[model samples]
Target: MIGVIGIIISLFLLMYLAYRGWSVILIAPVLACLAASFAIFDGGSFHMLATYTEKFMPALAGYIKAYFPMFLLGAVFGKVMDVSGSANAIAEFITTKIGKGKEIWAVVLSCAVITYGGVSLFVAAFAIYPIGAALFREADIPKRILPPAIALGAFTFTMTAIPGTPQIQNAIPMTFFGTDAFAAPILGIVAALIMLFGGMFWLTHVEKKAKAAGEGYGDHKNENLQIMDPQYLPSFVTSITPIIVVIVANFAFSKWILPSFDSSYLETDYDTSFKAVSGTWSLILALILGVALVILFNYKRFDKGVVECLKDGVQGSFLAVMNTASEVGYGNVIKTLAGFSLVAAGMLSISDNPLIGEAISSSVLAGITGSASGGLSIALATFSEQFIARASELGISPEVLHRVASVACGGLDTLPHNGAVITLLNVTGMTHKECYGNIGMCTVVIPAISCVAIIILGSMGIV
Candidate 1:
């Protein structure tokens, strides 16, 4: 009981301190030890230093070992896209076609198109914001609506529910489930359509109410807006080709290319099998191809030069991976406690359906951690075996489990403390009071609905 209290207290503090802007990399280890202190008092055998060194460090290092390439390549890919003006070019192409009067749709679709193409939501938000701001300003739409519009596209479907998205949220389940990015394709598409249309409907409704209320783009200074000159931007075709390369190359590698290779040497040489690592290998190769293609297509357009862009990307990946790795380490420490058995049992009892249990655990942890990937990683690392076993017992596919967990993490992860939500609001120069409710409507409420829909579909044997 005392140990359980410690786990609860550590989680609350983790959420609160993170919300207060403490770095997880700092807070996680401290909190893991805090929880361990309670475990020690509760008569559990855990040494704080040993736990940190033996348990936490191993978990953190293992995650980095497995995933650092994807993070590094993904960051570099996003940086190249941003610096080369491909992201802006794509956004401009979309918004220009949609035109000004349809500001909400234009903004959402612009963010969505680029995000679905494998750009980071942060990159998508930054690249699209200037154009989206200009559009909202011209259309007399409330500036506050812009963040949710961007969130609906970048943070929800494309981030999670969509098939073949290279977002780490979708990719995280692969190692655990032995699934690829396109897991449970039918259910993925179904949930994606729901998130797309449902979020669009809600944002459009918000636009209507704002129009009726006569609230124009609120008075605010849009400083450093930096809308790229259209002629300076790459052509739409050149801009979109790398994105297509990522998608097509990822599919090819995961489906046909990697499987054809005789990875028999993997078990002999590395003491692991090809099946265990192929999904990650596919993503790494695909992102490399994507990054190489981006440079090839826009080599001359790199204003800061290719090396600088690559350097920035490599630097950027370190923090992103370390933050999630810390959370993973924190979770690994928590699982070693005597209290965790009760917690595990309680999580499992959330529903008779293993899918529901998986979804709830993923969603709750993500909300607590304020990170979709962090939450998903912790939930899966700790509970995936049990989820797999229960799912198998019920004749469920790990593919459906993969898809459900991926989609569910995206649902609650947009809580007000989320970094992406905070950054989106900051970049758009909007207050949380002004924008977060609508952002919630799109990223939180709508995605939750889609999650429920997919879980139901999966339970109905639609997978």
Candidate 2:
């Protein structure tokens, strides 16, 4: 009972600290240490803190080793794409091919492709902004529309609504649940469609309201719609090669190659097999492809100048990556202190129904973490033993429970203060008020609806 109360209080205080702008990395661990101290002191100085620190320090190091390489690879990929001009070239090509009249659609479509191709939100934003701005200027669209539209395109659909996207929001679940990208493909597809249509509907409605009041909402027009000189361009094929390489590698490895390799050569466990494919190997492949693409595409332009651009791009992403990586330490603290485990255990204690237990646990953790990936990791790590036990006890399939958890991950997990959301708002120079409507739509409304739908579908054995 004391353990449970301590867990609850610690989680609440962590959320408060997060809300107050304290780094989760700092707050979560500090709270965990305090909770552990109380737990140990009450038990009469068992040296639990020293034991925990010794074990946790190594575990934390392992997590950093496992996680940061992937981030560094992703960062390098983004940098290469940015420096090689592939990102901009793709954006420009889409706008030109789609024509100027459908500028909004063009921007949205470009953003979707980039995001779906596994570009990070930050990369997607920086890559698409200039193009979106230029398109809006050319099509007489308002500046205000560009930011929201770009954000909507990048975040709402591909980030969560698409399966196998490698967006941390989606891919992180795979890390925790041992579920494949295709586990809830249909759910993701349906959710994405709803969000896409819903966003477009709101965008059009806003445009109409603004125009009706004669405010000239889209009144600004720039006459510069022409494509720039060919010297600044890379071929369309060159620009899309990295995306193709990553997707094909992921698919082949997951579907045919890894499975075959595993069946004959390696372990039968899904988690172990997936780690081989999605972990260091995938990152290495991505980095090689990105480097190769940059060299191949810019062979003529390769000089000291190219090196400088690469350096600048890498330097720019370093701080952001480090900040995000540091937050992982907070997540580690929560996991180490058994805070998440206590919460999961508490939820499971109240319910015999596995689905209900999962939903409740997901909601609580998601609410606390304010990050889908973070919450999913917590649930996965903390609840694995319980999940296996419950599945056997309830005659439920572990796979089904895992899938349900993954699906719930998409909807209930991303709260208002998600790093991605904050970063998007910061980059666009839009306040939460200007974009929270859309944010709420994606993070709250759609997730709520989708969670219920997934739960029902799973309950019915339809999924």
lDDT of each: 0.89, 0.62
Output the lDDT of residue 37, model 2.
54
Tens digits of lDDT, candidate 1, 350-458: 7889899999989988997889998899899888998899888888998899999999999899898888888888788888899889899889998898899989989
Best by TM-score: 1
Output the worst ten-in-a-row residue range by lDDT, candidate 1.
Answer: 39-48
For model 2, what is the error of residue 98's alpha carbon versus the real structure, in angstroms, after optimal superposition?
A: 3.5
lDDT tens digits, residues 1-463, model 2?
Answer: 4655665676678766765677765565566655565555345332446634654354445455655555555666677776666777888888889995777788888888777766666788877776776776656665566656776677666766566565555554455445545446666676677767776776667656765776442433442333345468788788888777776666565556655543433355443554434433543564556556666776665345766766765675555444443444445555555445655456888867676677666656666666665565556556766766766676665445655565566555446666666666666555676666656664556656655665666555554
* TM-score, cand. 2 vs. native: 0.78
- Which portions of model 1 show Cα errors greater than 4 Å? none
The candidate maximizing lDDT is 1
Query: How many residue pairs of model 2 clash at the backbone?
Result: 0
